[model samples]
Each structure stands twice: as C-alpha cells, then as structure tokens.
Target: MPRFRLLPDEQLARSPLSQLWREFARQHSAVAGLILFTAFFALAILAPLITPHGPYWQNDALLLLPPSWSELGLVQYPLGTDDLGRDLFSRILVGARYTFGIAVITVIGALLMGLLLGTLAGMSRGVKSSVFNHILDLALTIPSLLLAIIIVAILGPGLLNTTWAIMLALLPQFVHGIRNAIAEQLSQDYVIAYRLDGANNWQIFSRIVIPNIWEKLTLMATMALSTAILDIAALGFLGLGAQAPSAEWGAIIADSLDLIYIAPAGVAIPGLLIFLAVLSVNLVGDGLRTAAKKRREN
Candidate 1:
C-alpha cells in the first residue's frame, strides 16, 4: 500500500489565494482595485443595517430635499432625497444589492453554459468545433445591447428577464474564452500523453485540461462578472431592465434623469454607485489576471 503525504511547505506556498494576494500586493493598482471592490461589496451586504430608512418609502415633506448635514435640525439626509422624497442614500444602498445580485446570477449562468460548450468545442476536431465556433461568431457579431433589447422586448421588461438578456448576450464571450483556453491546452504534450495512455475524452477533459485551465477560467469568470454588472445597469438605464420603484441602480438613474435639475443627487447617487461598482470589479479582474499570470510563471 502506498502512503500519501501532505503537501510540503514549499508546495503549499503555491496555493491559490496566497499566491494571488502576494502578486496582487506587488501591484499598487491591484491593491487600490481590491479596496474599491471590497468597499462596494461591503456596502451591498450591509445596506439594511447601514441605511437610515426604507429605500422605497416616500415622504412628501422631504421630497426634493437637498443633501445636508442635518434634516429638520435633527436627522440628516447625507445624499438628499428624490422627487418623491425617498432617501437617496438608502435607495443607493439597497439598489446596490439589486444590481450586484442580478449581475452575479447572470454571470454565473453564462459562464457555466459557456464553459461546458467551449470545452466540448475545443476537445472536438473538424466539423464539430467549426460548427460551434461559427455559431459563437455569429452571436458575437451582433451588438450585445441590441440583442438584449430584442430579447427583452419579446420577454417583457423585469429583473429576471433582464438577467436572462444579459446572460444570453454574454454567453458567446465566455464560450470563446473557454474554447481558446482548451484549444491551447489540447496541443500541450501532457494532453497528448494522456490521450496516448488510452484515457477517455471525459477523463482527459476532467483530469488534465480542466485543471490546467482552471485558473484562466476563474479569471475570465471574474472579468465576465464585472462586465455583466455593467451591462445590466446599462440595460436598466435604457428602460429595458428592472421596473420603477425597484431600487435598482439603473432604474434609479432612469427615474432621476427627469429630476436632474431639481434633485441631482437622485441621479448622481445611483450613477456614481454603478460607476464605482463596475470600476471596482474591473480592478479586481485585473488583479486576478495579474495574480494568475504570476502563478503560471512560477
């Protein structure tokens, strides 16, 4: 019987998050990015506890109130209120949850489907790969926003439909990335050796190709998550997303656009949040990519 030993210190040093952080820390930009990302995620998670009022509750007296250090000499509206007198700060916080939640779901759905399809396409030779790749190319050729609009039009506007729209739009990109990664791995000597050893396609896929490309796929997933969030917000802003009074960032922005002059904070709050969230995600993606590259080099 053979006894298996735990990984030695040197081997353990190469663990995922550990190596990722080390490389990430070496890059100042990545550090800043992580901070931004963490802050927004924290905000989203803690919205209920942090916010002063219900995001959707309206107060006629407070309508269009300017952001101030103190409201009515007692309470304060830090980010002000919308035309309907809803707390901008509170709405922003709650909206963060909606925006982030939809983005996450859409990204995960698209990534899963794309990864499976891409893996199949890459492992196959000749007409199969060609057919899948062509389909992907066709999907990619169409403008994502336009495609999303059409889908939303048919499905009707709502949070779930918007998520579906974004997922369908993003699926092609994930498929392309995974397909490329698998194709590159397929040419590696280890893969050929695994095949020559009479390993079945599924065995080779699960044991060899997947493990090799896991890091890249993770990085792509993170990037796609960020993009998905942005796309969802964009769709919402265009009126093809979450409906009114939903406290979604895009919906808030769209609703506030009319009151820009009367109460700019309504629009600014959601817009700024959307921008920050997307920016933070992008930074995290860059950090993850950098970390992956470092691990690969090591």
Candidate 2:
C-alpha cells in the first residue's frame, strides 16, 4: 500500500486537444507561419506607439530617401521615406492595421453568417433546400473578387463599404461549403442513428455536424482570410477602397508606384508585406489540413 508505481507512457493518455496541438506543432512551416502572422498582428497593434514618426507626417527635405542601409539613408527613418517624405516604415506598420485587421473582421462575419444560414439550408427539406442550393450555386459562379467589386460599386467604395462587400462575397463560399459538408455528414450512419434516437435538428447540427466538419471550416476560414486581404488591397489600389491619406498597404503601393523607378523599395516593401501575409496564412492552413488528415488516419 505504501509503494507507488509510475504510470507507463501508454497509460499516460494525452487529451484530444493536446494530441491535436502536438500534431499541429510537428509541422515546422505552420509554426513559422503562426509566428510570422503573430508578429504582423503585433506590429499592427503597436504601430502608433512604436512608430518613430506619424504615418501622415511629411518631411520635405527627406523626400524619397532610401533605407537606413542605403548610401543616402538616414538613421532616423529605418525603412526610409516615401515619395511624399512620409516615413515608409511607419506607413507600413499603420497600414497593417487596416489590411490585416479588416480581413480578419470580414472573415469572422462571413463564417458566423455562413454557419447559421448553411445549417438551416442543409437541414431544410425538398424545395426549400433546392432553392437555397440553387442560390448558393448561382452566387458561387461569379468570381468572389468580381462579386465584391460589384457590391462595392453598388455600395459606393470606401474602407467600410469594402469590408461589407468582401464579407458578402465570401458568405456564399462559406455557406455552400458548410452546406455540402453538413449534407455529407448527415448521410453518415452515426447521424442516422442520432436521428433515429430522436435528436432534433439543432442538437444534431450542434453535436454531430459541427464537430465533423470543423477541419473543413478552419481550412475555409484561412483561405477566406487570404482572399480578403488580397481583395482589400486590390480594391484599395484601384481607389475603390481606402482613399487618399490612408496608409493601407494597397494604397501605399498605389501611391508609391510613380516612385518605383526612383525608389523601388517604397513600392516593394508594402507589396512584400501583402505577399508574406497571404503566404503565411496559406502555409498555416495547409499544415492544419495535413495535421487533421493524420489525426483522422490514426
């Protein structure tokens, strides 16, 4: 009775969450992507505090200055000055607030709306379901960006309008994907058993359908986020999103385009930030997909 025995490794069972975390962590690229995105988010949040100069501040004397490493660079402006003599580094940090922040908010809205509408549509019978499916299919046929642009055109383009337009454009994808996933999960024997056991539609959706399709949901979310970022930037570049005086990444690039020949880094830095944001999100999504697959196999 006084003797205590150590548990065997096999007996020391890990929780499902811990197991999933371990699986996700095994993918080095995913970890790197997570870290990268976190850094970007932090920079966005702390931009006002950490930036050496105001994003809108202009220095007539420092026009088109190169980065600190460049021959003509100044120590004060690490990433150098834009064509307007605004601090390029500060603009970048401030731009991240609009670019990354808007995409995140849009995706969350789309996901929530999708989950509600898709679940109802999936659970509907006969003609109602068919009508929902048809509408979703019709919406899906239009390219998301085109749909977003059309909505923005109708709503009158601005940052808030662009966010709404993108959310609406993304809604159909989430709805259709989730609807199909729920339908597939409903056909499974366990779901049938739940139905036979008298589980209501809400109960079944909450307990069975959602859990089964979480992986798909996560993948769609990441993909949607990346798309939102690009679309926001594109709209901003076209002057239909963030307007003049905004330091949004796309607007930054558009503003700096004229200076590309004279100060290439001005354009390149913002462009590179967009590229990295998209790439990191995609990498993390891919890693999660692989981890989910492996978890299922085991």
Candidate 3:
C-alpha cells in the first residue's frame, strides 16, 4: 500500500468555509486585515478580562490624565483617561463590540432583503424587472447619508433604529448588484438548458442561478461589511446612532471632540480604531474581489 498525504491547498479548497479562509490567507492585505480584525474582535470579546476598569466607571483622580510611562513611575493609564476619567483603552475595546455588532447586523439584514428582491426581479422579466429596477434606481439616486438620517429620524434614535437605518440605506446597492448579476446569468446557456429540462422557475433559480451568483454575492457582502461599519460610525458621530453611556466608538468620538485640547487621546483613540477597522475591512474586500476574479479566469 502506498503512503498518502493530503495536499494543503486541495484540502482547504474542498471545505466550504476553509476555501474562503485560504483565499483570504493567500492575499497579503487580506491576511493583514484578518489579523487586525481578529485582534479588535478579541479585544472586544475579552474586554472585561483585560481592562483595569469598567468602561462606564469614572474616577475623579484619574480625570484627564495623560498616558503614563513606567519609567516615570506613573503607569496607571495606558492610552490615557478621558474627561470623565474613564479609561480610553477600555472604552475603545467596548466600542469595538458595539460598532462591529451594528455593522454585522445591518449588513446581514440588507443582504437578505436584497438577495430576495433581486432574485425575484431576475426571475421575472418584463413588468416586474421594470418596476424593481426603477425602484432600485430611485433608491440609488438618493444620497445614502440623507436616506439614513431620514429613516433614523422617523424611527427614533437607538441601536435598533440605527441598524434599520443603515440596512435601508444599504439595501439599494445590493439590489442593484444582484439584479445585474442575475440578469446576466439568466442569459447564459445553462439557464436555458435548465429551463428546457422540465425544471420549474423556482427549481432553476434555487439550484442553478443562486449557486452561480453566490460568489459575486459574497464579494458584495464583504464590501458591504466595510460600508456598514463606516455608515454606523458616521451615524454615531452625528448623534443618531448608539447613544450616550453606550461606549460606542462614534459616541465616544463625539463626546471627546469638545475635550480634544484637554485630552487629545480621548478622541484620537476611538477615531484611530474606527479608521483601522474600516481600512482592514476594505482591504479584505479588495482581496476577495481579486481572488474571485482569478478563480473565474481559471
């Protein structure tokens, strides 16, 4: 009997989740983004264990304290203390949880709605396509920020409301992308063959169309994740997102703005984390797109 060894690439690509992971790891920026994202997530998840103080608790003695150096025998505050004497580091860790949670929820909601609407529109050509496409165009024509503000204002401010706002604002893009992909797929010979093989519309859609376009959908979802994070941060900055006492990054930045001169690190810390998170998401999205294109070409 011959000794057998599994090929690493072959094994990875054979598993559904591992295939994407392998693709992510092979790209330089994607790997870096994954590392940064994982670090932030870990910080968020392990906040209580790592943080010296609760994010909400404040101490007057520590108020507006600058970052301390061990050499100076003053090492209490690592990232410094905010105006209320709360640890900036702790707040940031908690804020990551809030921001990322909202983004993930919003993205998943938008993708679900868009996929359903887009698939429906694609399966039905004439009047259905026309109406759906017109609606999508109208939605796309509106400024996303303005739309989000309108929705949030109508729904009232809160985490749930903010998420709904982001989802509504994001749905149009997904609809548009999926509509285009599905329309193109419908024109392919495989679809015609499926139709001729006694396959009903639903069967053709479920078995053939969806699987073929899933890769594109995954790419869109990754890009949407970045956009969702940015949108939520913007909403928080404008006071329409995670409200006060929530330790959200946007709210943290908003509160720290007035105290920038007093403790610049307060604003800088949250802002830096938001920036890095969004950047990492975008890098990962770009890497996915590149890998997907290569896969298609091959």
Candidate 4:
C-alpha cells in the first residue's frame, strides 16, 4: 500500500508586516476597523478635491438647513448646513486632515522621541537610567491632557505648537514602555551570547534587540495613536488648537454648541466620527497585540 505525498508547492516567505497583516485581517473587528481607518484617511487626504463646496464658503440663505433626510432639509447638503451655511459634510471632510493629520504627527514624534530616550535608558546603568526613570515617573504622574495644556500654554496656540504639545504629552508612556521591553530583551540568552562574542551595545541592539522588540513598538505606537487623537480633540475643543474656519472635529463641535437645538447633527456627526476613529484604532491595536502574543507563544 502507498500513501499519497503532500503537495509539492513551497509556502510563500512572509515578512513580519505581511504576517501581521494576515493576522489582523483574520480578526473580524480588525478588518472592519482597517476599512474605516483607510476610508477616513482617504477622505482626509482627498477633501479638497472631493468636497462639493468650500469648507469656509458661506450663504445666509442656506444656513442651518437640516440633513437632506430631514423634513425640510436641502437635498444638496446631505449632512446639512451649519450656522454659517458652510457644508457640514465638507467641513468634516476637511476636519479629518487636521484631526487625523495631527494625530499622525503627534504619534510619530512621540514614537521617535520615546524610542530614543528609552534606548538610552535601557542601555545605560546608574545615572542615565535613573534620570530617565525619574522623568518617566514625573510624566506619568501628570495627566497627559494637563501636560499638553501646559505645553500649549507655554508655546502659545498654533498648529505646529499644538502637534508638539500632544507629542510631548504622550512621550512618557512610550519611553517607559519601550525601556522595559528593551531591558527585558537585553536580559535574554541571545543578547548575552552576542555580548560574549564582543558585540558592542549598538551592535547587539541593532542586530538582536530591535528585531525582537519591533512588534512591541508597533503595538505601542498604535495605542499611542488613539491617545493622540483624543488629546488633539480635547485641545481643539478648548480653543488651544486649529483656530476658526479650520474645521477640526472638536473645533467644529465647539463652534456648533450654540446651534445645538437647531442643528444637533453638527455636534453629533463630528462626535460620532471621533468615536468611530478612536474605536477603529483601538480595535486594530488590540488585533496587533493578540497577533503578537500568539507569535511569542509559538
């Protein structure tokens, strides 16, 4: 008797990103989040070309027209018109650029800064580590929003300053998290082996530690992104970020507060988008973490 042989086809080689994408795609919530996340960025990036009316264009006659779906709403303004007759749809579209764009900048800045400090702290002994730890503790104690508010206060309000403020506020969490991961990685047998082979700190870190902790960094970065968005929104709501006619979600909602009775959709739409955007990032981040944990186990 003869047994059938397994198929001869070779399994395709995959990179970590490809593997992570496959894993994230396998998760139902993650797939949905990815779709929404993609759509959100797409909308933001394409706002200028796609939006029917100028975000700042005003017409008193068209002011406060409810969503087309409403009884008296105009069909042309699907989401509705705001108090100033600017298209709520267009403004929200443009707002995505300010909201998500700033979030991206803040997350990236925080990531780089955190990774640098954490690496320094992790690699060093005594004073260097102690100083970083103390700073981390101090940062952790002060609330992130409060920290951002203080930074903005010092820098004065503007887009660049606001982005930096958000980044600074989020930096401590990254520093602490990355430092711990690096410290643990450095304690492993491979690292000790590399050291025995006369590897310098940079060599070991570049060759071993980074490869190992890369997944963890991605997870941390994704988590930080959600926090960044919330902070940016809070700043905009408090008049500390993108000023009038700029159309950030929180700013839009803040501006629309007076018209809550007549056009609550203005408030509700931006609020819903913020909720959806945060939820999407969180779900995707969770998926990445679940995938990472499973990988580590195997």
Candidate 5:
C-alpha cells in the first residue's frame, strides 16, 4: 500500500492560506485600513528617527503655539506645543507605541486563557460544562467597561494592572465564543469519522477542530482589539491608567482638554488618531467577515 506522509501534502503548500489572503485583499476598505494601520505602526517604529525632538522635550517659549502653517505659529513648532510645551507631533508618534501595544498584549492574554479553559469546557459535557457556562454567563452579564473599572480600582492604577484589568474584562467573551464554536464542531460528522479512525481526542482537537475554528477566532480577535484599545483609552482619560509625562493617547487627550479652547487641535489630533485606529481595526474585522461569508453560506 502506498503510505501516507505523516504530514499532509496540504501542509507543504499554503494554498488555503493564500486563498484566504486573496479574499482579504479583495476588500478595498479593509485593504485601505490595513495600509493605514501598517503606516501608523511603521511611523511608531521610526519615531526616534523621524521626530524632530524628544517627545518630552519642552520649549516654554513655544507654549500653545498653533500649527506652523497658522500665521500665529512658528515653523519649528509644526503642530504646535501643548500647555506644558511638549511637542505634539512627536508625542503622538510615541503615544502610538503605548496605546496600540498595550491593547494587543491584553487581548492576546485573554485569547490564550480563553482557549485553555474553553477547550476543556467544550470537550467535556454535563456538570463541568454547566459550571463553566454559568460562570461565563455571569461574567458576560456585567458590562465590560464596568468590570474593567472594578478590576482597576481593586488593583490600583498602573500600566501592568491596567493590562490585567482589560484582559480580565475581555476574558468572558472569548471563553464563551470559543466554547460554543468547539462544542458545535465536536458534533460534526468529521469528528465522528476521526473517532472511528482511532484518533484520540487530543489528536482530533489539534488536527481538526482548531484548524476549522481559526477563522472565527481571528474575526473575534480583530473586533476585541478595538474594544481593548477603547477601554484602555477610557481608563487613561479617567486618570486611572497611563499617568502624566507618559505618551499614551488617552493621557494626552485627558491632559490636553484644559487647553482645548487655546489649541483645539491639541485635543483633536490625539482623539482623531484613536478614532482612526479603532475604525481601521473594525474594517479588518469586516474583511474577515467577508472572507467567511461563503463558509457561513455552506
């Protein structure tokens, strides 16, 4: 008998992955969002090289100057200085690192924790599943922002604590979603066939279930990213997260509000960045949904 390779031929070629990318790229809005998002991060990474001065470097002489192009503004102060005279453009570039980085980390932690617990809950039934489901439902019933606030209040405010708080706030949704998807997959004929072929539960889960659910997980993660970023921003704005002198979008916005009438762009610039970032993330989620439309139809 011709023997099968231990690894399937499909593993040697990325046809499915390539097809998925082709579909994702076909979405013009998503593609545009991705391009802008990529540019944002690229600027973040190149901040040191591109920024004219350190983000924290202040010039008391230039306090509250408008955009350089504005007749009142100086050429050296392009977008102008905040009330404290910190460079607005440089600050925003650096803030991108903190604002986007923390959100991604918190969401990743939630995803991993959810995967471990959800897999166990979904693979088994009866009392254990019941217990997990009830707990998840209870957690989900609470609004996530409120849950985040509670966690932050309990832990005291700091960068690490804020990340953990966001992760905890987002955990239930991931767990519930993964659990439902896995339970649904477990009932399919393919799983039964795998059992008949003498594949153990672990093998079936790793080889079949995970591959099938990857798309949904990716979709959810994209959406969750926007939520995480927004929550982090809210916490910072409320003075419970990134504190003064830290280049975080929310902190910048919070601090700039007092100067809104003096330099409306000071408040507008950072706020617009946050809005654009979240919008682009949602666009990516839309792309994922479009890619999966056919699968849903089937």
Candidate 6:
C-alpha cells in the first residue's frame, strides 16, 4: 500500500490530452496569449457590470479629458474621454463584445457551413469536385478584407451586416481547408479498410475521417477566428461595420483619428488592444499547430 507516482512520460503516455497540453505549454508565448485572451473575453462578458460609465453616456464637461494619470486628468475617467465626452475605458471594455464576440460567432458559423459543404465537395468525383475546387480557388484569390467590404457594401453597414460579411468571406477558406484535409485523410489505407469492412460513407466520414483530421480542422478554426476578428475590425474602421454609438474598437479608433495629435493615447490605446487581441490569437494558433505537428511525429 506504499504511495506511487507516475512519471511525466508515463502520464503523457496514459493520456493523449495530457501530452497535447504539455506540448502546448512548451510555447511560453502561447501560454501568455491564452491568459490575455481569457482576460479580454472576461472583459467582454462582464463589461456592463465592471464599466464605471455607460459606453454611450456623454458628459460635455469631460470631453477630450486626458488619462487619469495625466496632470490634467480626473480620477473618475481612468483612460480619459473621447471627443464626444464618452468614457474611453468603458468603450474599450464594451468594444471587446463586437471585436471578439461577433468574430467568434462568425467563425463558428463559417466552420459549420464549411464542414458540410467541404465534406460534400471532398466526397464527390469528376465534374462536381472539379467545379467546386475551381470556385474555391477563385474565391481564395480575393483578399478577405476586400471580399468582406464588397459583401458589406451589398448588405449595408452595421454590426450584424459586418458579421455576415466576415462569415461569407471566411467560408471559402474554411471550405478549402476542410476539403483538402478530408481528401488527405481519405487517401489513408485505414479508409480503404473501413470501406472493405462494410462501413457506409456517412459512418466512415463521421467516425474515421473526422477523428483523423480533427487536429488539422482545429488548427484551421483557430487561425480563421483571428482572421475574422481582423476583418470585423477593419470593416468597423472603414465605416462599413459597427455603427456609431457602438463603441466597437475599430470604430473607436476611426472616431479618434482626428485627435491623434492632441490625444495620442485615444488612438494608440484602441489600436494597441486590437494588436494584442490579434497577436494573442495568432500565437495560440501557431502553438496549436506546432503541438499537433510534434504529436503526429511522435
């Protein structure tokens, strides 16, 4: 009845998830990214409760106030005020909803649609597959931001429309990635074995194909989410995404450009937030990709 403890290798060998987690943790930047992303997500979810002032609330007396740390600044408005007298800190906290939340939802929709369409395209042969691949290639040639802009133009401005536009733009990439992963997975000898063992196409796809290609799919999803966030922010900056009074990060940056010289922090802080969010997502995705590759090699 003496106590026993498993070694690191023993633990990893006993649990695939533990192995993956270990590999992921080896990347320090990715761990930091995960922490930053969690904080941003929490801010987005708890903005209403945590924010000192309403995102849209205005006080003429507080217009263009400097940060609280500044000599001229007031403690009440920590990050200071925008030209419209709205609280910058409050706006940033709330902006996470549009910047991160909508992008997440859009990426989820794109991945879902891509899985179905890509599976169909991957499973098809001759003319059907060829035609679909050609269409995907054509779509891939367009930059995501440009494609989103076109879609938003047709759908008109606002957060809802921008989300849809980003989704549509992202769909082609997801479809292409999924289709390729499926095709590659299907070429494995195990798939032929499954067919010979009397497995139906649906069963083989849902069980064998999906399980085998899950790592690649997950990597694609993480990368796609970062793209979606950037597209949403760019559209908002261009005045084609979230409308005024929304406090979306990109919109906040756009509204503060004129004040950059006078109130540099107003512009720099929001841009810095966007930079951090995108960097965090990319670092996490890169870490996942590296971990998956190492796992496969092992």
lDDT of 4: 0.87
- What residue pairs are clashing in model 6? none
Candidate 5 structure lDDT: 0.86
Angstrom error of the Cα, residue 41, model 4: value is: 1.7
Clashes in candidate 6: how many? 0
Best by TM-score: 6
In candidate 1 the C-alpha lDDT for residue 281 amounts to 79
The true-versus-predicted C-alpha distance at residue 212 of model 1, in Å, is 1.3
Q: What is the C-alpha lDDT of each candidate?
A: 0.82, 0.90, 0.82, 0.87, 0.86, 0.89
In model 3, the runs with Cα more than 4 Å from the true position are: 1-24, 70-74
Q: Over 4 Å off in model 4, which ranges?
A: 1-15
User: Regarding TM-score, does 1 or 3 come out ahead?
Assistant: 1
Instruction: Give RMSD (Å) of candidate 3 vs. truth.
Output: 4.9
TM-score versus the correct structure, for each prediction: 0.90, 0.94, 0.89, 0.93, 0.91, 0.95
Candidate 5 local lDDT, 52-124, one digit each (tens): 7789987888788788889998787688888878888888888887788788888899999989988988898
List per-candidate RMSD values in Å: 4.9, 4.7, 4.9, 3.6, 5.0, 4.3
- How do the residues 15-115 of candidate 2 rate in per-residue lDDT, one tens digit apiece? 55566667889999999998988888787788889888999998899899999998889999999998779999988889998999889999999999999
Per-residue lDDT of 1-298 in model 1, one digit per residue for the tens? 9987676688676767677778888888878877887887777788889889888889998777888764432256788888888888888888877798778778889889988889888888898778878988898888777788888999999888998988888888889989999989889898899899999988988898887888887788788877777778887888889888888888888898988887777787777777877787787888878777876676
Tell me the deviation in Å of residue 105 in model 4: 1.4
Candidate 3 C-alpha lDDT tens digits along 219-244: 88878888888878888889998888
Stretches > 4 Å off in candidate 5? 1-14, 295-298
Q: What's the best-to-worst order under TM-score? A: 6, 2, 4, 5, 1, 3
lDDT of 4 by residue, 1-298 (tens): 9986553333246666676676667789988887888888787788889888899999999989999999998878899999889999889998999898779878988899999989998888998689769978988999888999999999998777999999999999999988999999999998898899999988998989899888889889889888888888888999998788789999999999888998999899999999999998998899889877664553
Q: How accurate is candidate 3 locally (lDDT)?
A: 0.82
